[model samples]
Target: MLELTNVSSGYGETQVLYDLSVTAKAGRVLAVLGRNGAGKSTTLKTVMGLLPTRSGAISFDGATLPGKPYEVAKAGIGYVPETRDIFPSLTVRENLDLAAKRFEGSDWTIERVVELFPRLGERMSNGGTQLSGGEQQMLAIARALLMNPRLLILDEPTEGLAPVIVQQIHDKLMELKRGGLSMVLVEQNFGFATSLADDVAIVSKGQIVWTGSPAEIRADIEAQHRWLGV
Candidate 1:
């Protein structure tokens, strides 16, 4: 559903990605795992068009993703950046409403997202700033769901949260996976990423260094340590 071939991109003068290639199939999760400064987040940003691609190609659902963030989004990709990017002053309901898209034939509605995260229902009127970290994360994902995107891209969904909250987030993600949502997840938490991913790719210095199934990755401790420092 998503493919990047020899993609090279950077913030400005310093090039971060070099001939990076990766793929995420339809109705499956593809986790890009790496440690801090491994350029995992940069990969997502380039794919989402937040950073320009200097070389190579990126195609989603059989068409090229325009090199503009809004155009990429309008082309049916939902991105939840590591920053969470929630409007602090907007109410939970307001946030969802702001992201709701019908032009792409959305299958998700406010009711559906609220049902997926019941806590969101109770806090519909609460401002985004009022939510805890976990709650804020839920709100971010929930807003994306309302867009009914063809492919979901999430960066560090579980970062900086308590273990319990991480589990909660993981549970919801698994639920989404079961529902056949295509996702590209960039995460530093190897175990969490592998658990929900159908395929795994280890990224190092903005390039994919290893590609395998979760089981293969688990059995290769040396590869894990070398590429991921796990």
Candidate 2:
């Protein structure tokens, strides 16, 4: 459903991606893994057009994603950055309403989002700043779901949350995976990545150093450590 070919990009003068190539199939999850500073987040940002690419191409659902963030979002891609981009003052309902504004097809709705994360329903009118960390995360996911994205790009969805909340988030990911939602997940947590990823790509120094199934990755622990410092 998505493909990146030798994508090289950077923030201004310093390049962060070096000829990185990766692919994500529909109804599957591609777990992007690496140690910090391995350019994993940069890969997602570039793909989402949050950062400009100096070379190569990014295509989603058979068309190119131009180097523009709004255009990319409008082209049926939803991005939940590592920061989880939630508005502190916006109510839960307000947040979902904002994301739903640009949606134009049959994929997601506020009701579906609330169902996916029932907690959001209970706090529909609560401001983002009033939510717990886990609730905030759910709000972020709900906001993205309301966008009706064909492909969801999540950067560290489970970062810094409690273990139960992490498990909850994982369950949501697995649910989405079963529903055939194509996803690209960047995670530093190996256990979390292996549990949900259909494919794994170990990135290193701005390039994909290994691409294989999770089982294949386990069989080559030495390489995993070398590339991902696992």
Candidate 3:
């Protein structure tokens, strides 16, 4: 459903991604694994068109995404960033309402999101700042779900959350995957990655060094320690 070919991107004067090529197929989870500063997040940003690609191409659902954020989002890709990008001043209902504008099909809705994260239903009137980190994360995911995106890109969705919350998020992702949602997950938690991913792409020094099944990654202890610093 998504493809990146020989893509290179970075901040001004310092390239971070080195001809990185990756693909996330429909109805499969591609776990992108790397340590800090490994350019994993940069890859997602480039795919989302938030950062300019110095070279190469990104195509989603058979069309090349324009090098613009809105254009990419409009092309059926939803991004949930590391920061959880919720509007601090907006109520949960309002946040969800805003996302509803992007809905395309009957696959996703506020009711479905409320079922996924019941806490959001209880806090529908509360502003983003009033929600806890876990609550905010749920809100962010719920908002994305309301968009009914064909492909969901989650950047460290489990980062900094309690283990219970992480597990909850993991369960939701697995559920989505079973229901045929394509996802590219940028995850540091190997256990979580292994639980949901069909394949794993181990990245180092801004490029994909190893791409294989999750079990294959698990069996390769040397590659894990060398590239992931585990």
Local lDDT at 52 for model 3? 96
Candidate 3 residue pairs in clash (backbone atoms < 3 Å): none
TM-scores of the models, in the given order? 0.97, 0.97, 0.97
lDDT by residue (131-221, candidate 3, tens digit) is 9899999999888888778889999999899999998999889989998999999999999998899989988889999999999889899
The Cα RMSD in angstroms, rounded to one decimal, for candidate 1 relative to the true structure is 1.2
Please report the TM-score between candidate 3 and the true structure.
0.97
| lDDT minimum window of 10 residues, candidate 1 | 97-106
RMSD of each: 1.2, 1.1, 1.1
Question: How do the candidates rank by lDDT, highest first?
Answer: 1, 3, 2
Candidate 1 lDDT, 189-222, residue by residue in tens: 8889989999999888988999999999999999
How would you encode candidate 2's per-residue C-alpha lDDT over 168-222 as one tens digit per residue? 9999989998998999999988999988999999888999888899999888979
Please list the residue runs of candidate 2 whose C-alpha ends up more than 4 Å from where it truly belongs after superposition: 104-106
Better of 2 and 3 by lDDT: 3
Alpha-carbon deviation at 67 in model 2, angstroms? 1.6
